[model samples]
Target: MKKITQELIDRFYDLLSPCRLCPRNCGVDRINGELGNCGAGLEVKVASYHQHFGEEPPLVGRSGSGTIFFSHCNLHCVFCQNYEISQLGQGQRVSLEELAQYMLDLQNSGCHNINLVTPTPWVPQIVSGLKIAQERGLHIPVVYNCGGYEAVSTLKLLDGIIDIYMPDIKYSDDQCAEKYSKVKNYWSVVRSALKEMYYQVGNLKLSRGIAASGLLIRHLVLPNQLAGTKECFKFIAENLSIKIVVNVMAQYYPTFNAHKYPEINRRITLSEYRAAIDILKSYGLDAGFQQTIDTLYRKAIPEWGEWS
Candidate 1:
């Protein structure tokens, strides 16, 4: 495979000056440190970096995914699990060279891939860092972990840079999306983004039990939201190829400001999760991990070491 280069990095940096990077289309002048709706600028602010074992089995494997948690997000969901980092921007600012070095450090620590968490707003910066890291001999697969509301044009810039695409299909209904994530046209934008992602990477691929390329669509089952889950699965089956790896996550806990919304203000019941699984099975989409209800509350709270 062709390696990411410094020229690519420089080009990405140039594009971020006046950022039109995500679906929000904030067009914030990020180069001069102007904050957008996402509350982020040109420089990357990272909360933490480490090898995370809590991801999907294929991505995590035995070692773990080299996770670099980027601060702030384009779609600031009310029930965000990582609200501290994504909402409050609780992290230190680092240069492109420092971020590249962090990737190398994780690789040296025996991680399987470089997993970028909530990287939509900082896609340009991440791409630049990846190129620099690749030049410095970083060879692990790059995982573009993001919320599903991505801009297709922004993702086009990462055509060859990112190897694995793991995007969350949060909601199938725009009303639910608006009520929960505060994004009005969430489903429409995310559906288009998913199509673009599926077109770019096609179906999921694995080598020796490790994911190298392709898409992994994740749907987190929420309380009193089985119908939404069914709609999302049906759409995936009809629109995209059913051969895609779909992870039906049951790790929904009332976090951040979820209490304000009564519908999703609590943990998902076992029945709710099972109903979602039943819907996926009905569609003949048996591709990814199913989070157990017992395991959901076992570690509900986010730990500092989770970044590690």
Candidate 2:
């Protein structure tokens, strides 16, 4: 693995000036106190941070993945489960130095890895913090948990900085993406982003049942086939690799503003979830995890942050 040098950190911080950190490419000078489309400024805003066991098995093995949830996502998903943080911008802004301490603190708490949730817009600050943390002997794997609407150029900057790439393959259809997430060309953008992510980290690699590095694709089974599960699986099996770890998430409940769309105004039925599993198996992409329908229902159905 290439070392994350001070020069690399400087280059990443430069991106914040023009703010091409994510796919949105708002081009606003964030260094001068301008907010981008993602609603982030020079300071990093965090909703919460905690040791979370609700993540994938590999990520949550033994202890837990130290998750830092960022505020205000780039994609405005109408049915977002965590709308309070992602849409409403509910988080406290902290300096980059303080953010570095959070990473070290998670490591001190015996977290297996530093999992960054919704971290795309704040990549510059993240990289800066990682550099500081590295100097302080922070050596756990860094997980880039994002919504998959990433820019290849931006991801290239994180080639060695990020280890585990846990990204959502949200939609295979641009129409559905635009209608639901208010993002343009979501299919193409995510497709290219996934390819770049795979190229950077390859297939998911585990060490002692815990994720050490590599790519893990997350495909949430949206109701009424809006997420295009079959298409996403086909693309992964053919274009990427069957060896890639894929989490066919079945916890699609109508939360936030999902009632506005009748098609996705309910939880995914058992048959729907079963069909998605069948499709996943048919593609021969079998190295990942799945949530049982019973497990989803047993959990409290609330539109809240995972940190709380």
Candidate 3:
């Protein structure tokens, strides 16, 4: 009922032939089992799906957000917390029908929304499943939770289908992005993607204190300002309004191969978090959330499942 038209679905699946779902543009025929840079094959692979409360406030209202964690990300960050799923591809390959069932099950369990994490590569398949799920009385809002790297053309296919766009503004500098996430054009791509997403779903809107639709950005403050928080805040304030909800994440630690880089080999200091908060205020970006620095001491490992 939310405009997942047959024509739109068809156009999205066509992208799979050349596999230009994300910015990689691998051109590999994913329909024929050619793997792309995202490490995903033609099959729809899902790491897990559950009512997760570890998300943002509005998304975690009384019933948690129904999060379907997709394996293999478009931007495989070297310091990825869910390295097992994103790097090693630890997930179960599911058919489009099965994926729809998963959505229906989550809705039945009283989830706030269907949160699709790292879903770029499998957009076509996800949309197909969404069509079936919507037809089967699945009406919960669909949240496109993704890494910053996205293609505008691919996102256009999801125009009316996706209600919430929660994306990360990983780096303000392309050089830092290339070094950290192996993406040289990340800054440029994300800017366009964020603009398109904002155009689709304006600022964050809530219904009875629950997020009904909008764009919420997550900016993970890395050690020694490696995330370029200053420039990021400025860009968001100038381009995308300062009133946009932004989650200033402070839970950064040396995860996976992060230790390989000395600059990011340790947890961020309280001063660093304060600096980011200061920048946020300087930009008049008050509509967002920030984590307590004390939580970083608790050793919050990623909730993603094991490699087995």
Candidate 4:
């Protein structure tokens, strides 16, 4: 693998002055401290940093995934669990050097990988930080944890940068996406995004039982929304190879603005989750982990920065 260097990092930072970092195409001049739809500028704002154990097993193996939750999101989903950071913009802005230092600190603390949560809008800035961390001997795999609505061109730039591509295939229908995420063509967009991500990172690759590279697609089963889930899994089975890791998430609870929307106002029932899992099994796509009912109930809520 090609080593991440400071020169590559500098070029990435240069792209952010006129930020076209995400699929939103806000094109706001972030260099002069202007905010776009993501509510972020040249500087990266982080909500918190910790060794997060709440992620999928491989990513959080042994020590835990070194999670750095970035504030604000390109897609403003109504049921966002981390609305305080994503919508309310409650985080402190840090320089690229400072962000890189944080990554090294996490590694020094025995983290498995530097898992960047909701990092679409700040890709360039994060790359810059990763390069800096690399210079300081940060060698752990980098996980690109994002919402599925990503730009193909933006992902192309991240070709040799990211190791593991962990994205949520949120919705498979335009109506559901439009109603919940306010994105008009989210279905097509996410499909294209996932294809590109799969192309970049093939099947899930592990070393010593820890994820080192490849794609791990996540899907949260929502209440009264099996149509989207069925279509999503079908697309995954047909288009992508069956070797890819798929996490059938069953922990959908009413959060953020979900109460305002009647369709998603309640938690997903046991039947709903089981049906999704059954569909996965029926399709002969059995290459990933399925959370137990107890695991879902216990770890659904955020643990407020606790590792393990």
Candidate 5:
């Protein structure tokens, strides 16, 4: 029912030949088992799928958001909470038709949207499967939940397809991103990606307490200002819009290989969270959700599983 043409699907699948999907631009032939930075093969591997209520309120609503956690990730962050799935192999391979069925199943369960998590690696397969799902009467908003290290060219292919762009503005500095997330030129790439996403869909628009379509950014406040909340907020306010929905996350903890980096191997201090809030307020980017400082103290350990 949507404008998911065969031509659009072909364009995305062609990227897998040399695999120019993400900014990594590894150019590896993923179809032939050649591994790229994300290490995803041709098939659509899925870690999990369910109605997730832990997401932002608008996405969750009353029925809960449909979450399909994809296998592997382009940005292998040292502090990734979902390291088992994103870094190590923890997903089961599924056919394109099966992938489409997952989407339909979620919709049948009364989900508000299809939240595709860490889906940058398998964009080609996702597009093809989404076409099948769209043709089979799937009519929910498709949420592109990803780390902000996206390629504008690749995202262009998803222009008319994706309804909501919920990406994390992970870092405002390339050095920090490279050191922790193993990404190059992250600062520059994320900015361009964010602009393109905003161009496709404007600020987040809610319909009866549910997100209909738009860009909702998430910025996790890392310990000791590692996330550079000030610069990220400033860029969003000045470039994107002050009306943008930015979920300033406080769910950072030492996990996966995060202990290797002593600077970021600890939970963010209360003062640090407050400082990040101050920066968000200074830019008047207050249209989104903000977690209370005490929320961090409740999580003694990193018990929460976060995709971003």
Candidate 6:
């Protein structure tokens, strides 16, 4: 593994001037306080940091996944359950040192890994913080939990740094992506992003029944076939390794601005979720962790930031 050097940190921070950290390529100078489409600055802002057991069983043993919810998102999804944190940007800015301390603190709490949620816009600063965190004995695997929309160039910068590349494979159809998430060419971008991530770290590796490294994809089952599981699973099975674990998430509940779009205004039915899972299984993709339909009904819909 490559050590997080000051030179490497500088290399990432320099990208802030042009700010092509995400797929948006907004070209805004984030260093000079110019907000890009992602609405993040040079500093890293975190909404919350805690040991969350709500994650997958492998990620959450007896302890929990050390989850850090970052504010703002690259994709403006109409049904974002965590709109307050992702779209509204409800979080506090923390210095690089402070971010490093959070890593150590989470490690001290006996959590498995540092799970960074919606960390797309803050990659540069996150790397800077990791430099400090690693030097201070932060030895646990770092999970890059992000939305599927990612820049391959930006992801390359984190090739060796990010241990577990856990990302959401939102949609296989670009039209659905643009309509729901308001992102252009999302399917094209995500396909490349997943390839790069899998290239960096292949399939999920477990130690003592806990995830230590590699890729775990999430595909949220949307109401009405908006998620397009067949094509998404086909791509993963044919392009990436079928051994790669995929979490077929059925927790989509209408929130935020979802009511504006009638197609996705209601929660997904059990049959809809099951069909998506069938698609996943047909592709020979490992259904990593699953929630029973009864369990889904019994539990409250967790905010995306909190859902892991």
- RMSD to native for every prediction? 4.4, 4.3, 5.0, 4.0, 3.7, 3.5
Candidate 1 on 53-152: residue-level lDDT in tens?
A: 8888778889999999999988878889899999999999999899999999999999999999999888777877877788889998889999988888
Candidate 6 lowest-lDDT run of ten: 299-308
For candidate 3, write residues 1-308 as lDDT tens digits. 37578888889878988888888898999889899998888889999999998898788789999999999988878889899988889899999999999999999999999999999989999999999999999998999999979999998878888999999999988898999899889988999999999999999888987889999999998998999999888989999987688888888878989988999999888899889989988998876666666656674332211111
Residue-by-residue lDDT tens digits, candidate 4, 146-256: 988888878887887888999999988888888888788888889998999899889888788788899998988889973378888888989997666788887778899
Off by over 4 Å in 6: 300-308
Q: Give residue 131's lDDT in candidate 4 (0 to 100).
A: 74
Total colliding residue pairs, candidate 3: 0
Give the per-residue lDDT digits (tens) of candidate 2, residues 1-308.
25668888788888888988888889999999999888888888999999988888788888899999999899999999889999999999988788889999999999999999999888888888888888888899999999999989989888877899999999999999999999998999999999999998998887987888999998898888889999999999999998887887877789999999999999888888788889988998876656665645676222211110
Candidate 3 collision pairs: none
TM-score preference between candidates 1 and 5, better one: 5
Q: Per lDDT, what order, best first?
A: 5, 3, 6, 2, 4, 1
Q: Give the clashing pairs for model 5.
A: none
Q: List TM-scores for all candidates, in order.
A: 0.93, 0.94, 0.95, 0.93, 0.96, 0.95
Among all candidates shown, the one with the greatest lDDT:
5
Give lDDT tens digits, candidate 6, residues 201-266.
Answer: 988888987888889998898999989889989999999988878877777889999999999999
Residue 164 local lDDT, model 1: 88
What's the lDDT for candidate 4? 0.83
Counted clashes in each candidate structure: 0, 0, 0, 0, 0, 0
Report how far off residue 166 is in candidate 3 (Å). Answer: 0.4
lDDT of each: 0.83, 0.87, 0.88, 0.83, 0.89, 0.87
